[model samples]
Every structure is written in C-alpha cells, then in structure tokens.
Target: MKIDTQGDTIRIYDFNAEECFRIARRLENQSLKLYQGIKAAIKDADIAAALDILIAEELCHLAYCEKALIDMGVDDINAEHLVEVVDTGVVTPLAQADIERVLCNRQEALKLGIALEKRAIAFYESILAETGNEQGRIALGNIIEQERGHRERLQALIS
Candidate 1:
C-alpha cells in the first residue's frame, strides 16, 4: 500500500459525492496500512494490542465509506455537479518514512496515533462545513466524533 505523497495529496476544492467517498476510502486504506505497519514494527505487546483496536476502527470506517458509495449509486466519479465548494486538500496520513522516523518507542507511536486521528478529524470537519446535504453533514459529524474518540484513547494511553 505505497502512497505517493505528491500525487495523493492533490487538493480538490470542489468535488461531488462520489469523489468525496472515494477519497475518504482511500484515506482509510492509508490509515489501516500505517497502523498495521506500526504494529509490525513495535515489540511491546501492550502497544501492539492498542494498535489492533485502532486498526479495527479504521476497517469499520473504510467499510462505511464503501457502503456510502454503494448507497449513493456512485459507480464512478465524474467530477461534475459538486455538492459544495471549499478549500480542501487530500487528507494525508503519515507517510511510511514519517512513521519509521517517529516509531522509536511506544510513547512515540501513541503520539503518532494522536496526530493521525487529529488529521482525520480535521478532514471530516472541513468536509462537514462544506457539505450541503443534511445526510452528508450528519454522517461527517459522526465520523468526526469517532476520530476524536480515537485521539482521546491514544492520549489516555500516553498519560
């Protein structure tokens, strides 16, 4: 699951529903890979166990993104008729190199987790702000809260 930071980080200020969900799914996949890689690198069982929970959460989120696309009948992203416009960029999770540089210990891993969750929350919030449909706004709100919970859990582990 190698992601090119430059290509994947292209900001799409105006995107339709299909594009939104596809980008979300892509971010979730990146997140899952990051957590899995970190879990593989860490020796401590306790930290690995925590990463397992985060990985599971990311999986659920990814599934939700897929289901959303299905429910919307979005067979393809045409990049036409956007829901709203805003200053939005691709939500980039920590790259492989960033993860490796930061994963010195359990504490550092937890810190990275916090940062990852923060990015997720920010991405959803930005989308939420620009979302015109009530359903989309509600869904984005729920996702933002879930990401916040992930951040709080990592913070508790660090404390």
Candidate 2:
C-alpha cells in the first residue's frame, strides 16, 4: 500500500488492515527520527531535554504500532519490510523548510510538533474511514485521540 500526499490532501492506494498497521508503524518511526534530528541540531540544553521526552513518547507510540501489527496477525515486523511497504517521502508531514525553522527556534519546534500530531490525527482518521472492521476503526480512533492529546500538549508549550 502507498500514500500519496499532495498539498493538504492525502490519497491512499491499495490499503488494507495490515497495511494500515504497517503505515502507522512507519509514521511513528519517522516522527521519532524527526524528534531525534531536531534534538541533535539544537544547542539549547533545556530544549534538548524537552525533545528527549518527546522522543520517549514516540518510542511508546512505535511500540503500540508494533503491537497493533502483531495483533492483526502480522508475524514479522521487520523494518526493511515496512520501508518497502511505504515510502517515507509520501507520508512525511514536515518539509525541509519546517525542519530549518525548528532548528532555529524552540517555539518553531513546538509548532512543528503540533503540526506533525495534527497530520498523524488526519492519517488515522483516514484509516478509520477506509476500514470496515470494527476493531480496526476502534484502534485507529484511539490513535487519533492520542495524537490529539499530543497536539494539545504542544499547543500548551507554544502558548
């Protein structure tokens, strides 16, 4: 399955329950890498520490995605397989300009974090819309709620 993103719209092609889980796992991993990259680029100790906490949260989100895959009967959760399943370029919400802003200002980093969480929420909501399975919808809904919470936390930081 593949996700095509154009401007603010996302089109999902040949998506299934298993692919949904795989996509979630891939996005979580991407977000984790983004946080780590931002942490490395910033010199402020306080901002770095805050990013560390976000990194830990992303780790937990990744674990949840892995478990969701396992529960969906995916026996193998290989990183290489996930990469082949979906290209990161299509799913990544942050662009080079956003990353540049994040590196220069802590407030910009928080805004970027909020934007990423909003994108994750939209992705999960899209999955929920595509899914016919009750369990899958419930799972995706839960993930959307979590992303909303993350967005709210980031919003608070910016405020």
Candidate 3:
C-alpha cells in the first residue's frame, strides 16, 4: 500500500470498510518487518525481548484485520490493490524502504517504534470517528487501544 502525502497531510479518497482494513493490515505488516529487522541487528537481549513482544502484538493485529476483512466477505485483500487517497493530519507509517536506514542504534529504533505506534493510534482513531458500521467501530477502538499500549511500551524503553 502506498500513501500519498502533501506536506504534513495524507489524502486517502473513497475508502470503504475493506479498504480501511487492508490499509490497517498493511501498516501492521510494515511494523512487523521493521521490528524484525531491528531485532536482528540489536545485540541487547532486553531490547530484543521487548521487540519480540511487539512482534507478537503486530502479528495479532494483522490477524485481526484479516479476520475483519473475511467477516466482511472480502476473501482476498492484495496490498498491491490498495489505491486510496486520505487527506488528514495524522502521522503516516514509515515507508518500507526506510527500515534499514532508520535503525542506527537501539535508542533510535525505540523512538521509531514509538512514532510508528503513534501513527497507528492516530490513524485508527480517525477511522473510528468516520466509521458507521458498529463492528468496524469496535474493531478500530480495540486496535486503537492496542496501538496506545504499543506506544507506551516503546516510550517506557526510551525512558
């Protein structure tokens, strides 16, 4: 999934429930890859353990989105097919290519994780506000809470 950004704003136009879920899953996938890469590079056992927890959490998130899409009768969601433009001031997930470049050290990795969680939380909250479906709203709320926890965990590591 590609995100189009204009300055500090992102524009995602004509997005439906399935599209939203796909985008969410894509974000989670990106997070998973990022954490995995950092974990592989970091030699600190404690930080690696923390990243392991985050990796598991991201896996669960991806599963949730997959199930949500299936429940909505969407059997297959291809990341390549994501073509919506969102216009919002929320923080966007880091691009996949930036993963290696962003991992300079443990502290930087932790900071990046915090920023990633913040972006997910903000994006979910924005979607929750606009979602009309009861199930979709509930799912978004749950994901928002999870993202908040992720942010807190990363923040604690930074502290």
Candidate 4:
C-alpha cells in the first residue's frame, strides 16, 4: 500500500467520525506490525510488556474511531480513508542486539511514525477549530491528543 498518501494531509479539516475510523483502522494495522516486530527483536520481559501496552493503545484508538464513525452515520458510506502503512523493509528479521543500542530499521519506522502523528495531530487540531458541533470538536481534540501521545512514545522508542 502507498505509505505516505499525498494530497491534502489536512483532510480532517472536514472530517467526521468515519474519516477517523478509516485512519484509525490503518494505524491499528501498522501498530500491530510494529509491536510484532519489536517483540521478535527483544527478549526482555519488561520491554515486551511495554510493547504490549502500545499495541493495546493502538487498538483502543481504533475502537474509538470506529465508534465515532458509527455514531456519525458515515460508517456505511464507504470511502478511502487514506491511512498510510509503514515501510515493509522495517519488518525484516535480524540476529538482533541490545534494544537500547537501537535497530536502524526500527529507527526508520519510528521516524515515519512520528511524522504521521504530527500530520494526524495537525489534522484534528484544525478540525477541532472548524467543527460546528461540540461533540465533533471534542472528538477531534481527543484524537489529536491520542496521536500526539503515540508520537511521543515512538520518539522515546527511537531515542
């Protein structure tokens, strides 16, 4: 799949819950892959637990998006949500080393993840500004925060 879907990255400016759901679904898939890769690379129990938490957070975010779509009545409308996937090269298995030492491939993925989160946060922040209803604005604000949280977590992973 095309990872960095080009064209207005600011689509959330006019987005409803369905849009969020679509994007969240993509993020959920990407996060699953990321966590699985990290799990394979690390042997430590605590790091694995942290990765598990990250995966669950992504799932929860996806659920929130889906619920919003359902509530907005756009879940049935079927449109491409433009969720970008991570680069496939990052998934390659290696002999592996210190998780604290940094894996180059995972680092690349982390960089991309940060950029994606920035875009998502910007999108929702703009939407929150434009949203006519309180619920929509609140949802956008919350989603923006979630994306920001992910960005911070991913930043920590690479650093």
Q: In each prediction, how many residue pairs overlap at the backbone (N, C-alpha, C within less than 3 A)? A: 0, 0, 8, 0
Question: In model 1, which residue pairs have backbone atoms overlapping below 3 Å?
Answer: none
Q: Which stretches of candidate 1 lie above 4 Å from their native place?
A: 1-11, 14-18, 73-98, 133-135
lDDT of 4 by residue, 1-159 (tens): 112335865232444444445655665566567666766777666556656656676777777776777777774634654433322222233224433433334454456456546766765565467656655556666777778788788788767
Model 1: how far residue 20 lies from native, Å: 3.2
Winning candidate number (lDDT): 2
Name the weakest run of 10 consecutive residues (lDDT summed) in model 4: 86-95
- Which scores greater on lDDT, model 3 or model 4? 3
In model 2, residue pairs whose N, Cα or C atoms come closer than 3 Å (at least 3 residues apart or on different chains), thus clashing, are: none
Best by TM-score: 2
Candidate 2 overall lDDT versus native: 0.72
Q: Which stretches in model 3 have alpha-carbon errors above 4 Å?
A: 1-10, 84-111, 126-139, 152-159
Query: What lDDT tens digits, residue by residue, belong to model 3 across residues 99-157?
Result: 55444455666666777787778777776776666666666666677678768876887
TM-scores for all candidates: the values are: 0.65, 0.76, 0.64, 0.51
RMSD of candidates 1 onward, in order: 7.1, 4.5, 5.6, 7.7
List lDDT for all candidates, in order.
Answer: 0.67, 0.72, 0.68, 0.57
Tens digit of per-residue lDDT, candidate 1, span 1-159: 111246558434333456566656677777788788778887877677777777887888788877887888776533433332322343353467767755555677677767878877787777666666665566666567767876887798789
Give candidate 4's whole-model lDDT. Answer: 0.57
Evaluated against the true structure, the overall lDDT of model 3 is 0.68
